[model samples]
Target: MNTKLMGSALIISGTALGAGMLAIPMVLAQFGLLYGTLLMVLIWFGTTYSALLLLEATIKSGGGLGLNSIARKTLGKGGQLLTNGLLYALLICLLMAYILGAADLLVQAASALGLELTFMHSQIIFTLTTGVIVACGTGVIDKLNRLLFFVMLASLLMTLAVLLPEFSTDNLSQVSNSDHIGLIKTSAVLFTSFGFMVVIPSLVSYNSEASDKQLRNMVIVGSIIPLVCYLCWLFAVVGNLPAGQLKEFASVSELMAGFEHDAPWVGGFLSVFTGLALLTSFFGVAMSLFHQNSDTFNQNRVVTYVLTFVLPLVGAILAADQFLSVLAYAGIILVFLAVFVPLAMVYKLRLANALPERYTAEGGNVMMVFALLFGGFLLASQVI
Candidate 1:
């Protein structure tokens, strides 16, 4: 049972660590280790707390309904619309980022294999292939996601191990010209790194028979693994690469190009690993989107799959080639759906006596205020 739960944990961790892993070191390099570590720790605790609140709510709802449906019952029509709309937007934006990341990594991998495909071709191929796997149904998605996630996670560890002997102490300690503004800016980017909460409903439904302890354990292990992975990734990448070289790339391709120029072997591993990372995330979000739509529309499986898969591909095509900016937007929406909604759901649950006396995530009214403030700070960052 623990082993089975661990796989679910790994799925959430893998989803959280993707796309953002490639950028975290550079983002943190500016803030330096002291501040960067502090911020991630706070964010992890807060997010973990909120995720448990979500778990409690999921458990209380008795597993028959999806998130939006539960919200409709607990939070009325406005809450339902807010969650349904923003959550869908968040997943679509995340899907777009993954598609873009995959295409870039695919081009690099193809060149190494001498396939020589164009960017457009790679993106289309990746989208269509992943789409088919997703359309197979949620069960297929669960199996494939586990396989891809562990592959990606293992490669990341291996890449870091290979690169370890070259790490410079000063590379991590070296101070850059960072200010409050830089930290805030990087925080906005890093905020969405812990976005596995959106998929918690899918996992709960998949393992509908799990106990409260089992559910809590997976959420903790699942979220903490990514938190540790991101920190270690920052340590390895920052300690190995100079600040100037690390920050030079505004894009993943350029960053990967720097890696190849500096260390060709490591770069080769990174390109492949990043590709798998993107695919794992793509599978995770796409699975959640498929299930969410399937439950909402009460439609045929084939139709829901097509609708879920097609929208993101179209969005990716229409979206700008940029990656980080989309994530920043996604983060704002994610915090609301993932972090903020739980506050309301739990508060409502407490008042209505929906929660059992044994529930662990019995959140306070004050926590809701803090969540609201934190979410507002994030929203204000986007506009200002």
Candidate 2:
């Protein structure tokens, strides 16, 4: 792969594989391995297609434009407002999830090392540490994220190796909750895991000289990397812990606590893995949010930095235990930016013949409607 393409692809993968992956086993434990794996692949496909749609629109409008600009060009000011509103909500919710998750892991890691810290203290420490890195800008984030991504990959593999010895095929079949509604709710949260679409426009500008095929391949390759890792993670975790047992934990931190008692070694490796996962995710999402806020508000760098991290930091502090809930809500907002906005932009662009010679996303109206209906069902499933 071209170095630029590979870097961009890594960005997508890093963004997609966050603390969100930490919740997969917890959610999948209720549905069993077979059904959960299917759901993972289904959401992966939907999210990848939506990303292509966004890429098509971005390339057509020229690279480097933010979501607000793309929506404005293709769907007007109302569209811009809708995109901006949803993007803000989705990004902040994700940042809050990462902050809360990373803080919990930080506390755990500290306790293991004979040090102690309150959850609130860990939250502030983790946020400020990672926030400074994000504030350094995208160029720095790209390099650091790539290096951290590799460390995260190593820890994940090591964690899986430690846990796989205890894996049982019988546990994979253990479904304590088979209710479709519960599965739907879990699916809504799982959908957010593949939300690399938010960063596509930035990637386009970052690799402006790349060919269209290179960009498309980058999205597919980047996203598929996480799907493979997630499936392996699900198999390792769920195959070892029965759904009935996993269901009892109130939060992912509690689940991590369970790991510490059952296997201190696995907990050590997992703490490293989960922490880096959240850290890299913070870099990816925070970079985008930082840029998006700056572009939308036309603020100075200090103001944009404050706009990007302050709200999410406050949210993480106040609702430190709402990690899973924040993810579910982010998933709900993701349906709009990841599905509806991309399809809408592409449809309008085609209607205006604005992208006549540009590379179009393969699917036509049928695919668009399928995406809409599918996304709508996921949204409705949340409330009903």
Candidate 3:
């Protein structure tokens, strides 16, 4: 892969492997290994397809523009409003997840070092630290992302290596054939883990010089990393914990506690992995939020600061539990904006006879129709 393409791939993979990864074992453990793994792969395929569609829309647009700009150019005012609104909501929900996730891990880390801190205090501190880093702008975030991504990868490998010895196929057969409600909820939670859309538009601008082929390869490869990672993570986690205990796992920490029971080293390593995952995601999401305010809208820095970081921080603190719930909600909403809207942009472009000669999306209307049905089915599953 080209260095630029590799970097782009890492960004997408990093964002996808956020708190949602940590939260995965909690939600999916109930659906058991078989059903949960299948649902995750399905969602991954859909998310990857949607991300490529978004990429196609971005390429058709000139360059250096975000999703809102592309939607406006392609879909008119209503499209712009819908795309931007959903993007803002999606980003805020994501930031909220990171804030709570970071705070939880920070508190655990501090206690391990014998320096106790409350969740609220750790959250406030994390907010301040993130605010400072995000203020430095996208260039800094991109550079920092590359370095932290390696650490995140290392931490993940360490966790997996430590737990692999404990893995048992005994847990893989636990399946729920009659519990559709539980299965649906599990799918909703897993949906949030595939959070690659928020950064897709940014990737186009980040690698403006790269060809369509390079970008598509990067997106596909990037999405694949998370799928593989999630598969490993779910296999290890579900295999290690009993079905009875997993059904009662109130949070990810509880799930980790179960893992740590057998492997003492897992506790500290998981904290590091989870924290790094949260930060990697935080940087990408914060940059996208900030850039939208500053570069896209020409808003004041302070205004952007509040909207991008502070507001979500407040929201996360006020209703941390609800923030997790909104991850599922936002994942559902993202189907329309991230999946359908991009497909809409393409169809609109085609119908209007406005497709630039340099189009890159494959399958044309056939692919669009297929993706639309896929997204609709995914959305319907969550709703029903």
**Which candidate wins on lDDT?**
2
Evaluate all candidate structures by whole-model CA lDDT and list the values in order: 0.78, 0.83, 0.78
lDDT (0-100) at residue 166 of candidate 1? 81
> Which regions of candidate 2 fall more than 4 Å away from where they truly are?
none
Cα lDDT, model 1, residue 280: 74
Write down the lDDT that model 3 would get. Answer: 0.78
TM-score, prediction 2: 0.96
Reference-based TM-score of each model = 0.94, 0.96, 0.94
Q: lDDT tens string, model 1, 197-303?
A: 87788788777767888888899999988888888888887787787677766677887776666667787678768788777778778878887887789888778
- Candidate 2 residue lDDT tens string, 92-211: 999999999888888878887899899989888888778778777767878888888899899999988888777788877888888867787786788999878888887888788888
Best by TM-score: 2
Q: Using alpha carbons, what is the TM-score of model 3?
A: 0.94
Question: What are the runs in model 1 whose C-alpha is more than 4 Å off?
Answer: 362-366
Worst 10 residues of 2 by lDDT: 61-70
- Worst 10-residue lDDT window for candidate 1 reads 355-364
